[model samples]
Target: MHQDLITLKKICKPIENDLKEFQLEFDNALSSEVRLINSISKYIIKNRGKNIRPILTILSSRLCGEPTPNSYRAAAMMELLHIATLIHDDVVDDATLRRGRPSINKVWKNKLSVLMGDFILSKALINMVRLNDFDALKQISTTAEKLSAGEILQIEKSITRTMTESIYFDMINQKTASLIATSCELGAITTSKLEEDRQSTHSFGQYLGMAFQIKDDLFDILGNESDTGKNSGGDVKKNMWTLPLIFSKNNMTRSQYRLLNKLLNKKRKDGHILKKIYHMVEETGGIDYAKNKLDDFSNRAIDSISSYPNSVIKQSLVDLVGFNVNRVK
Candidate 1:
């Protein structure tokens, strides 16, 4: 994992510099009468994330042709939208921690946290309008809607025992993958005139996003809480259906299914029961099966990017997919 981060640093150095510049611009752009909004926004920015979405946007543009001012703007917009979603998600999840730190709702009241999320989302949309690109605005707006719908679907299905693999895939695709696909497509569209390149870039982002989420699902079952920077077995606690749990349930005997169903239906907090469920999932090859699916999605991501001309940017994008697959937490 250490070596992978080092390699990622080398691959992402140039893009990181560009991303930093964009971040500066983004910080400068956030001005409003709401001082509390600014404070919350700054707090959110203080704990920097992996910047995967913005990096993808910039790198996709460069791989298609050359980086431009428009690409930088789009990248900044993408990050803003993502951060806003995180704020909203933390609220929805009633999560106490995010990225290993106290979540906004934990620090402040839920009302303030919810308002902050709305403020950030409004800022992102305003910036998108400033870009004055109808297509970009439309794409981002649609992605945001899909993300909302997906979240609702997941919440509705929480603790459901009958979730199918197809439903799980569909949920992740909408919840996690669509925004990523938009980032790449918007990046290419900002820098390139070729429709084919734009489509391919979107495909690359979609596959990569799928792989990324699948890895996250695996981590939920197998990762340490400290390593993942979130509560381990959070999905299990929420009774959210994921690929691993779905596969494991399918392979369980009638008696095993009855036991698992009882645990799922308990509606009570019990660590021992959760651990038992985790062990059952592992014994059923749930984690391994999810990993294999991640492998397939990662390969598809690589293939989607392979169509582009060779460059450091392309290689970096490919390496990102590799990192996503191998990431422990």
Candidate 2:
């Protein structure tokens, strides 16, 4: 993972100077609130995330034309929105750790964490309004709504035994892909005048985002919890039916299905039965099926960007899809 981040840094070097400006912009945007809230917000920023979404925004903008103020603002907005979601996600997952550290809710109380999330999200909108870009505002607002809807859908489906592939796609599209699409669209809107270019960028982001989420689902089943900074088999433990579990369950015998149902419905605190179910998912072709789906999405992402004039930035975007799908952790 260290080496991978290094490689990503090398790839993003061209935009390094611009990213610095964005960091400053983001820092300046965070106002000094009451001492406790300010401290919590600063703590959240100190444990900085990967900043992948913002990188995508900047890189996509560079792919189309020179980096502009709008690109930086958009990147900052994307990062703020992403951080807000992470804060909320930790609460929903009852997650104790994030990015290999204690989560905000774990360190502080849940109420404080929730309010911090709201603050960050409000700051993002305030920045967008400052940009005075109506289209950007509309796109981000729509994506935020979709993200909330996706979360609700996932919560609604949690613990259910029969999650269809289509429903899974829908859930991921709203939860993960919508923000990515907005990032790319915002990038294109910054530079490109043609409607087709903007549409293509949006499509590219959507495909890449889908591929990214599918890969993440695969990793949860097969990856090291220590490396991913997430508890392995969390989906199973929470009785949340992901794609792999769904595919594996479809192939189970009636007796196996009964065991699976019993396991999912179990009220036990310990996760022994859930571990067995994860092993079952591995034994079946669940992980393999997800890999194939990831490949399909990656290919679609490549196709979406094929129309762009060949440039280093465009090539980097293509390479990023490959990286996202093949990431082991």
Estimate every model's Cα lDDT from 0 to 1.
0.83, 0.82
**Candidate 1: 10-residue stretch with minimal lDDT:** 155-164
Tens digits of per-residue lDDT, candidate 2, 72-111, equal 9889999999999999888878888787888999888789
lDDT of 1: 0.83
Candidate 1, clashing residue pairs?
159-239
Poorly placed runs, candidate 2 (over 4 Å):
159-162, 268-272
- Residues 263-329 of candidate 1: C-alpha lDDT, one tens digit per residue: 8777774678778888898898888899899999999989987767787888889888888877665
For candidate 1, the per-residue lDDT at 39 reads 83
Query: Residue 191 of candidate 1: its Cα lDDT?
Result: 83
Q: What is the lDDT of residue 47 in candidate 1?
A: 78
RMSD of 2: 1.7
Assess every candidate by TM-score. Answer: 0.95, 0.95
Report residue 294 deviation for candidate 2 (angstroms).
Answer: 1.1
